[model samples]
Every structure is written in structure tokens, then in C-alpha cells.
Target chain A: MSITAILINAFALVCLIYGFYRDRDKAVKSLKKAAKSLFGILPTILIIIIIIGLMLGFVPPAEISRFVGEQSGILGVLLVGAVGAVLHIPALIAFPLAASMLESGATVMAVAAFITTLTMIGIVTLPMEIKILGKKFALLRNGLSFIIAIIIAILIGVIL
Target chain B: MLLAGMFIVALILVSIYPDRRGAVFNTSMDYLTEMAFILPAVMVLMGLFSVYIPEETVVKHLGKASGSKGFFLAILFGTLPTGPLYVAFPMASTLIKKGARISNIVVFLSAWACIKIPQEMVELQFLGPEFMLARLSLTIIFVGLMGFVIEWMMKRTNGVIDG
Candidate 1:
């Protein structure tokens, strides 16, 4: 596997070992929770993988990028960013989708904007935020997040 | 529902373009394997963090700090791998009720939303070091800035709460 993957596995292993040493019950409980969550998210993961395949295997880069490609510019970035904000995909799954789009011609800016906004702003959970944190705090956090999401995207596009 | 739609699309593509079926299958398998490598590990890490570091611990520790130290505490506590952002909203409310600064709460919630370690590991795996690291560092700076701006805006609109 990639070195990053290796490091992740290694880190997990170390954490697991240490966790068990600290408390065997909690460590096993964690593994159980891990298994449960994995099964729960599995279908979504499969669906996302399939989507990524279709995106990269069939669509040519030029065609894919037309809307989100480098030349698609600020409008493209904003479009994907809005989708990110509205959609409620798990961020783990979102990464592969974002990476697939990047491979298939989406601009760095657009992809960054999508992931950033997707994780940062949650339309589905906005009401909960509003209920708990009040309308003003919820609105400001989400609103400013959108603006910075674009700014971060543009900065990423320029740097990388 | 989306999964069912994806499966139907995949079936149709395989049937209509038999030649491309192998390509699609192979690509999906490739990504599936990659995800298989990290998802469980990430989940395990998350579970461990959640179990080891309970919300009570966060409230107890973060409730004590204010000013610059509180901002760093918020970011640090937020970066500890936990559940989803929705799980954080109530935790944030508790922080506020406990008298944490609005700027710190904003920073805490933003970091909780975007900058956890497992999330970073996934981003690093998929998006490369440069992309992951750049977005991360930029996120830290911008989220911190957003926190202060939001705090300023809130004070302007609602006046200052003495709590």
C-alpha cells in the first residue's frame, strides 16, 4: 500500500495496542464500535466507489472538467461548494469522490471548495445548530464558512 | 436510496457497454481496496478517542480557560477525533453555558467540523500531502480568523453577554 496507508495502519495498531494495555474492555469495545460503524457505512462506501469508477473510467478529463475543471473558474468552484454545503455525505466517502473528480479534470480549487464546504457547513444539521447555538451563531458560522471555503479554495488553486 | 440508484446505473453501464465493464469493475475494486485499508483503522481510532476522551472531559478542561489559552484549548479539544459535527453542537452549547468565549467556541466548532486527525489521515491518503497539508494549515488560519470575526459580529449585534 501507499506509505500514508502504511502509516495510518501503523498508527491504528499502536493506538490499539496502547488502548488494550490501558484497558482491555474499552479497547475491545472500541473494536466493536469500529466494526459496527464500518458495517453501517459500508453501503455508502460501495456506492461512492462505484461512482468514482464511473467518473474516472468513462468520463474524459476534458468533459469532466468543463464544469469543475481548471478553466471552469470561480463559478465552478462556487457551484461545487454549494453542493458540498447542502449534501450530507460522510467526509470519509467525500474524499474519494473528491479525489476521483480531481483525477478526472476537476480543478484543485473546485475540489478543495467542495471538501472544505462539505465538512464545514451542514445544511441537514443547521436546524440542530440553530436550536442549540441560536440562529445568529449558526448563521454566522455557516455564512462565514462559505465565504472562507471559497477563499481557501482559491488559495489552494494558486499554490497547488 | 442513492446506493440503489448507483447500482442500477452500474448495471446498465455494464450491460450496455460490455467492453467497459471490466474497466469499471477494476477501477471500483482498486478504490475499494484502498478504502478498505484505511476506513477500519480510522474508525477504530475514532472509537478509541470517543471512548477515552468523553465530552465531560472536554467541558471540564475547556471550561476553565479563557482568552488566548482558551482558543488553543478549543482547537486542541476539537481536533480530538470524535463523532460528527451534529454531535458537537450540543457540546458547543454546553461550552458556552460554561462561559467559554464565543471566539473559542467558534474555533472549537470549526476545528471539530474540518480538522480532526482521522479526517486528515483520509485526506492525506486521497488528496496527497501537499493538498492535505495546505488545506489543513489554511483551514487553521481561516477558521481562527472566522472565529474572531463571528465573535465580533455577535457582540455588535447582540451586545455582550456577561456570562
Candidate 2:
């Protein structure tokens, strides 16, 4: 596990321990809730895993860079943003890839759009989001997020 | 049924492009491992929040009267070193159920997704201070506005919107 993952688990453990010490029944209740939720979402989680695997595995690297390359302009930024919205790579991995794109002459706007949309929108997780948070909230948040991600990228381009 | 269909399609794809099987499997395993580590802990945290923190308290903090304080609080809570965006969905649902303002919840979510501290550090390391700072500031402004805009649209649409 990554250090961040370890730390997160440790934090959860600490919280559980503290809760148990204060109120065993409530702590157990939380554990039950946790287990229930984990099981409930397992299928969606599996789907997310498979989808992410396909996206990252199948897309050619050259194609990826080309879609968001410097010469691509606003259309390139839009394409990069769309890919970022669909591709579910962790931000931890996304930064280095984005940086490399920058190094290889991807425009500032395209890179920015890629990172922003990658973090903000999740087409793969849309069903789970809709299931949990309702269709309106999910669709609106993601739809608006996509628009604003591009706007942020453009503004970044203008500024720097 | 969808899952089964997806599985079959994947099977066919792998059979057709045997050369890509390793990449697909390895990537799937990598993500599965990552999710295994994080999801349970995230669920536990959510459960703890649900059980320990009273609904009224949550409502008070981020509910209808959450006000501008809720906005900043959402940003603060969101920027904490939580996991990814998918993990935030359940928590956001719980908050909404507890009567948290939709706008604040949106801000919290966007912040959780984009401005997590470690991600920012990585951005700084890779993309330079200028790019990082500019994007950060711009993201904050635009994400906040997006939240309000979405919230307004939801309210304006009224019961027509199932949000």
C-alpha cells in the first residue's frame, strides 16, 4: 500500500478505537453500517475497476498525448477534458502524466483541463453517484463541473 | 445483467486482442488492490460520522442555515486528505440527507476532488508554483460559483428536479 493509503487506514483505525473506548455500542453500530455499505457498493466498485482498467490499458499513449497536445488548441483541450472526465486514474498518478505532457509540448490549457476534469467528473462512477446522491445532483454537479473545468483551463491559459 | 454483459464483452476483447490481456489484467488488479485498501476505511469513516455525529449537528453545521460559514467549512473539510471523488459520494449523500445545503455539499465535493493537500503538493512538484497557484485559485473561485449555480438551478427547477 502507498503511504497515503496506510495513513488513511491508520486514521480510520484510530477513529474506530476512540469511538469504541467512548461507546462500544455505537462503534459497533458504525462497523455494521460500514460493512453494510461496503457490501452494498461492491458491484459498482467492481464495475469501476474494470472500466478504469480498460480505459488506461487500451488507449494508446501516443493517441492520448496527441488528443491533448500543444498543437491541438481549444479542440485539444476539450478532448483532453473529455478523456479526463472518463478516465479514472488517481490524481497521484495523473500529475506525473500531465507534467510529462507539458514537457512534450502539450498546451498549458490542455493539461489544466485534463487534471481538472479528471478530478472533477467521473463517467465511470456516474451510476453509483446517481444511486447514492440522486440523478439531478450527480448530473448537475458533473455537467457543471465539466463546463467549469474547461473555463478554469482557459483562464489558466490566459493568465500563464 | 449489465455486469454480465460487460464481462462477456471484456472476455471477447481479450480473446481478440491477446496481446492486450496483460495490460488489462495488471491495471485491473492494481485498481482492485487500491480500492481494497481504501474503500473499507472510507466506509468506516462515513459510518462513524453517521453514528457519532448527530443528524441535527450535521444539519446545523451544513444545513439550510449553514450560510457562508458552511461554504468555508465545506472547503475546509473537502481539502482534508480524504480519498478520491467516488468515496465522497456516499458522504455527500449522508450530508444531504442530514439537510446539508446542496451548494455547500457541492463545494465540499469539488474541493475534495481537486484541492486535496497531497494532490496540490504533487502539482507543485511537477507543474511549478505558478501553474499550481493559478489553477488552485481559479479552481476555488470557479468551483464555488459552480456550486452556487447548480444549487440555484436545482431550487429554481423545484420539484421538477429530483435533486
Q: Which candidate's lDDT is highest?
A: 1
lDDT of 1 by residue, B1-163 (tens): 8889999999898899888888889989989998988998999998898888889999988877987888888889999957789998888888888888888888898899888888889998989999999999999899989988998998897744332
Lowest lDDT 10-residue stretch of candidate 2 chain B:
B55-64
| lDDT (10s digit) by residue, model 2, range B1-163 | 6667777888888889899899879877866776676667767876786687653453456555478788888886777634678887877877877677888889989998998764665566557789999999999899889988988988887723343
lDDT tens per residue, model 1, A1-160: 9999999999999999999999999999989988888898899999889988887778878997899987888999999999999999888888899988888889999999999999999999998888888888898899999999999999999999
Candidate 1: lDDT of A47? 89
TM-score of chain A of 1: 0.96
Q: What is the TM-score of chain B alone in each candidate?
A: 0.91, 0.60
Clashes of 2: 0
Residue-level error in angstroms, candidate 2, position B137: 0.5
The worst-scoring run of ten residues by lDDT in candidate 1 chain A lies at: A52-61
